[model samples]
Target: MSSAPSIPSAPSTHPAPPAGWQATFSEAVRLQSENRWEQALTLLLPLAEQMPHEASVQNLTAVLLAQHGRLAEAVVLWQRLLAADPGNVALVANLGRACWMLERKQQALEYFSLAVQLQPQDPLALLNMGAIHQGEGRFEEALAWYERVFAVDPHHVQALFNSAQLHADAGRFTRAHELYRRVLAIDSKHVIAQAQLIFTQHYLEHPSPAQLSALARRLGAQCAAQSPVFSNWLVSFEPERPLRIGLLSADLHDHPVGYFIEGLLAHSAGKEVTWIAYANNEKRTALTERIAPAFSAWNEVFRWSDDQLAARIRSDRIDILLDLSGMGSGHRLGVLARRPAPVQVNWLGYFGTTGLPGVQAVIADPRCVPEPEEHWFSERVWRLPSTRYCFTPPKNAPEVAELPALRQGALTFGCFQTLAKINPRVIAAWARIAQRAPQARWRIRCGVKSSEEDRRSLAQRLVQAGIAADRFKVEAPLERQRYLASYGEIDVALDTFPYPGGTTSAEALWMGVPTLTLSTPGMLGRQGEQIMGAAGMAENWICFDEDAYVDRAVALAQRSAWLALAEQRRAMREQVAGSALFDNARFSRDWHELVRNIWRDACEQVISRSSQGISGPKP
Candidate 1:
């Protein structure tokens, strides 16, 4: 809803307005009704000056500025008024919110803390504090503040959704799903909650791929129904002009998606394709700096709503829009649902189908979406000549040490995975491995930092499954260099099923510790397969079932087989370093071909439709 400045009667102590004040205020109101916000503010500023002591006029103006998307201006105005009356709780809370919109977290926390000090039960203040903690990865503190908000306002939807997200990130899918459903029961149309429920399904040991697709498709249909798909694109049809492609994602900073696409963005920007970045993330890391110069245009669009971003893409005349974050954090699939471009492709960021019919295609490789598994996707599969991802080797990774088993005299294994991936089924499988190879020592690194209680609970579960505390060790998270160095202690890396490793699996191969992966029927299951295939370990490492997974784990530990892997470990790093997975130049050439082919396809379809006299978007 559009809003404008509103003026209410001041107290008796304020000076009475001049005789023409009534008529002038009415004129401003009329201007506001006509959507002339600037004219309305112009008329009201003079009236506000007539009573300097009454702060209401300036406050209203600040709100108007905020509503008009001038968050920094709103913060400045709020600060100026706050100097006069520092005790104003509403003004303090407003400053916190404005600062938050500007992505100034520490400043927002300072103001929100003051607001909470003044009004102990303020839900907004409490919620903002929780959000700051959540973003910083201080999970327990975030949940505590959220609990306070619930105590004050039990049905606070935002708090519920965020708290649920904390659970989901910590791998407590059951609790997260419960909270998502609770939010849904209150407001059934919440798009992200719907997406979150489906995201949790990716981790299930035996999830119904069809059911997951049906649910995601329902979400796609709902968003499409409400979106305004652009049909009147002003793009030229001439064969040889440079094509503008927009990459939309929030993970362009210190993440797996960052590592995968940064090289491509750099290598592809030089040629006929003009790669534009719509970075949906707010935080900028070292990786962001490395990749920023690669793009022809970089837009910090974390704050752009779907309508705002869609309009911007249309205005930029982007020929193709690529979704980089997929169903993961900070995805702008809602904008894709709007059909903002002539061709939108779902690629590197997500696995499987987005379920949005508006998305014309998904970038695939022979490994990810084999011909038999093509039914899993909703969009047409545009298979690439090489791997799905082009990896950028971590600069800090240590050289592979002599295979850990040779010195230890028994097989040693490690899995550095999130708690979300280490479910009961995985634990059971590991327990079976422990029974088969009694001398096999295993190490688990729990990256889940939500609470100490959860960590202890995981350790207890391992013991309950008959793995002695002496035979296994559980460790906390470490920094990148140290984390990579730890791989030297393990002869083999154990991969989780269904929701198998993506980045960790690739890293395992890079460190010469081949991961034993269980590939199931879905894209989530195929991540390990893709990484292994790209790293040239397809036949020896990838397993199709639990029996095969167990067999491989056992077989690979035998004296002769273990020695072969140990020998391979010495050369594994350079082998993968030279493969299609890490060849940026090769990946770029493939991408150039991809962009040209998809554009040609889009142009041919448009021309065919024109010949048929068909008009409007492709629906």
Candidate 2:
């Protein structure tokens, strides 16, 4: 979304217009001030044509046109106005914004550059420039622009939020958390910041599950207050009719969530279910093409408003709606909050509870959400027969290579998790293991190649943890194929605690490399433990504490232990390949049964309530 502010409406700032036209222009401006934009536009259009050379009339008309989504027309009008007064910063900024809305990136940047030169203190111009740089993956450049914005206005919420997001993305969660806190202090109801704060808590020191749940619940309640829940769905409770299951998510492409759901979508359901996909993003990948056919119907709901999407689901008579995105990226929790379907379940995309009252349950296996930890979630813990996750390996993945330890003369321990999860404690544990097993090599994928600052910071932290600086190296992130193939270079993959590697751990196992996991409290922590159990790896590889984790990792890197792991890693991959993790047919049966039974159980409850003259409560 374009962040450019509208042209300021200060009449005194402009030159006096011709005598007879003053009242008419004043009336138009008055209408705009009164929020009657349509009336304002109507009054300005004829005046704009009659007084073709009038800067005030033309600029006003262009602003109106831009507000009405006529970006091309607005751009032309602004261009003409700029030719008349080339140094007008407002005109320059407005033109830049119109070009941006039209997706003319280069033109927008040029005009924005002039706007900044004309008025270096303009907040809107700086913000837009930051957004463009951030979009292009120039993180440092984007941060520089945001820093300029902060210098001008420390309370600038957008700049603060954007910078926080970049920090979070680069795995500097502590800094991200600081910025998010500042934004919330300025504006308590900032939705994105609230969600981001919830997401960031885990990456820091151990965050209590209850505290996170409470925060998520607040967000859920906030969304629920937007629109009233609907409860008048009239449908036949037939046990045999095909259940209409609607899936809402933005990650329908080749992402971590996409990989997790691939097998479930591919599993044939025959007539037992009708799958409808609500892809919340426009950019689709080859993985998108692969999953499209599996759905009975597909709708690109990216442009759909919450009410519009909820109405569509209600109109479609969807029996069950699964929220795949939860509070993660591209989540439309508002639609779910409106209770668009009879039953709503939180699924694979997010590991934790959604904390949404609209969502009835969270899909998990017994191992993922063990009986004792069931209270951690706001939603009911609906346990699957085995593992809740099923995998579909990437088509481009190479065959598992022989373990590098045999030929490389020493074992190498690696962790390719996102920088955000490698907290201070994780760094300390890894340092301990590195120090104990001095002959073993360490490669920690901190983030992108440009994340030099983060790598340097991590390196400093490792040294602080008592490990020799020369014994370890912080590596740059790898491309997908290379990242997967690079796994064979290591004897063992070390999982990060609290927010352990989910997709990374799975991929390492697929590449015939085993991961040693340490259990921690929250939902995200359980993923590593669960994935290891699902893959039928050695249970001894999972440690209960940091001390155990360090001990187990060092023990695995010993000469004899490393020698034996060459064959164990290959066998581990075979185990994962043969396990329920990739069994699409078995996963399909279990998933469908779960969905079917959940709806049937819901329908029966509604019927029983109706018979007893009691009202069924909204989820």
TM-score of each: 0.88, 0.85
Q: Write the per-residue lDDT of candidate 2 for residues 1-619, one digit (tens) a residue.
A: 3344343332233444546787888998998775566688888887777776787888898987876667798887887777767778888878877777677887788878877877889998798789878876788899999999999999999999999999888777778899999999999877778888887777776788888888898888887776678976645666557788898999999788888888887776584777899998867888899999988789987756677788889998888899988878788877888888878999988877777788888889977888898887888888788888888876778888888878888888888887777788888887778778888887777545347777787788888888787777788877777877777677788998888888888888888888899877766777888888877764787778889898988888888886578777667656787887767788888888887778777877777778888875342
Candidate 1 on 215-324: residue-level lDDT in tens?
87888888788777777776876446788888888888878899898778768755777778898866889999998887778988776568778888988888888998
After superposing candidate 2 on the true structure, give the runs of residues whose Cα lies further than 4 Å from its correct spot. Answer: 1-108, 448-450, 615-619
Error of 1 at 590 (Å): 1.9
Compute the lDDT of residue 469 as modeled in candidate 2.
76
- What lDDT would candidate 2 get against the real structure? 0.80
Model 2, 410: alpha-carbon shift in Å? 0.9
